[model samples]
Target: MGHRLADTSSPARLAAPDEGIGRDELALATRNHGLPLEALRYDVTPPGLHYVLTHYDIPYVPDDTAWRLSVTGRVQRPLHLDLADLKGFPQVTTRVTLECAGNGRALLTPRPVSQPWLVEAVGTAEWTGVPLRLLLAAAGVDADAVDVVFTGADHGVERGVEQDYQRSLPIDVATGTEPEVLVAHAMNGAPLPPQHGRPLRLIVPGWYGMAHVKWLREVAVTDAPFTGFQQSVAYRLRQESGEEGEPVTRIVPRALLVPPGFPDFMSRARVVRPGTVPLEGRAWSGRAPVTRVDVSTDAGRTWREAELEPDDGRPWAWRRWHFGWTAAEGEYELSARATDAEGHTQPLQQPWNRGGFANNLVQRVPVLCLAKEG
Candidate 1:
């Protein structure tokens, strides 16, 4: 089955600039929280402060002891392993930065009508689990296996299609060792939080958050490309309704600023005292290491290179960058732009798509430089 479309109108739609956020989007925002810009100061976001977006309800798993992760289909040796059994495998820990494909959806001119995110749907965390390749090796992927489908316990309906929240990886990506994917059971050194996928989750470093199937229970190796809802109908980069656009895979390069100074309660604009002000933030690229970060205090009119910190050896994690600004007493605008080793850079103007995926527009912040008390 390929490209399942909703016969009668669908839930997914786009909102024009003047229409504003609808009630449905607001409700989704209430449940799916964004990372507070201030929390960008931390290298690893705490569970609560980290962004959360659940497509369906968080399934309650009172007893994970009885739960078994089944690895089946197109494999010689199918296996069912319990939580303890998974823990028994030789463990590897990885630091990963997961960003929602729709991180900047709300900022789009005719915004995608789903999550309504405004660039805060991201967080970096230390993930611990058994490497997915190890399990595949043990199971013996069939000669004709093409895609490995991951099925999570969370189930829901989207665009008139009901699915169990499934996604797949090509055989090469599923087995690659370069950035080893994990059947993660721990986040930030602690057992997975309930919202983060209590018993288990699939962590595909560098890929969008949708690829990280949470509350994972089944890993099925398939002989054909998996055309389930997520893999085909959703998450594609289509401009028109039925176009099968490019697949949204590795994350595009993105840089976020730690909003300077304090925020007003409602407006949330920044206020900085006049003088030399320290500026810093994080940058990451799933495509390659973030090689450069540029700061622009006057929108994108001019840019200054910020010093990048040496990579901490975590290939998939975000890197910190710093810049200093001589603050004169005046109103100003601020922004950060990132470039990856692959030469991909943030676009000053966001590229539009139906789903609003991979919108790496430079982050612009408004700042009021207060005069010093004489």
Candidate 2:
């Protein structure tokens, strides 16, 4: 056998230039980012820092002639649409929060086995597009269809295996709802950047990032299950039983379980001296709108209800809340739980799975106490 590895540092890199945007800038953007709560019900999502989830290193901006969305598979009339054709329909927009199912995975203990993401991995944005249902209806989608498969223009190799990021939704998820779903061509208030699926992408709000396939190039309606790598092998939960089998690989709704008061989950480098710190965070749900957010400073022994903001649009957006307590001189554990409108309360700990999908357990933060500043 030849040498197992070659010199590593000299390999070609397709990485984009720094673009003068550093991690600190991104962090600040995330920290200060705000959604127009009043605009949540509208179709236009607010422009900047709209949540983005992508599998490609850079967005592919195709020329107008090169951009085509194919509607094939089980349709009575197969259709191919260009950018102008999609724009001809009366455009609609809605302010929706697009969250990565893996958002906040870094906060889990034992590190929960996946991407190291902080709170910023998710975002809310107003997406404008032609409702996919309209297009599918125009093409006369078959009644026997089971799933809607979406593919994009980006492709690459991972672990020496060629793969392109794509996703599928159940027929119920794809065509059941009004404004049904979207083949989004615009994000926020501007044309999508080349790095952000300029021509088209899918915007299926409330589901995990996997549901919102980007760089959309094709839409196929099928009666059979889509068992591709991105769907079957990658974004699935692994069972601890260690049996050679496929785990349940579908999107399940999860709620953002925020405690009454914000607890710092980790040490802060910004604080020179520590004192009583005020805490605040946001809570949300997918199954139902969050009704009550509870806080527990004494490790779930005693609980208090935090003040909750009025409902924005029922179940589509997160409600913000606040909690405050005097910092005592010692180490403390802080935690939060959320209850949905249907009386579904968040669990203290969610079960762990192999692929670590949808881990929305109650959020806990560790805080430190310090002497009063002189």
Tell me the TM-score of each prediction against the true structure: 0.97, 0.75
Q: Model 1's lDDT to the true fold? A: 0.91
Tens-digit lDDT string for candidate 1 (192-269): 999999889999999999999999999999998999989888899988987988889999999999999888889999
**Residue 307 local lDDT, model 2:** 73
Q: How high a TM-score does candidate 1 get?
A: 0.97
Q: How far does residue 201 in candidate 2 sit from its true spot (Å)?
A: 1.3
- Per-residue CA lDDT of model 2 for 1-374, tens digit only, reads 56322322122111233333345335534443333222333333445544454454555464756788999999999998898899997787866656666655554554443344544454556678988888888888898999889987778643344667777887777876632578888877677766557778887755666777778889999999887767766666665424334533222333332222233435431121255455555666655667787777676778788777786663455666667666666666666777876777766676555455566666555555656666
RMSD of each: 2.8, 7.4
Candidate 2 residue 121 C-alpha distance from true site, Å? 2.7
Candidate 2 — which pairs collide? 43-93, 43-94, 45-126, 51-123, 238-355, 259-336, 262-279
Worst 10 residues of 1 by lDDT: 1-10
- Candidate 2: residue 272 lDDT (0-100): 17
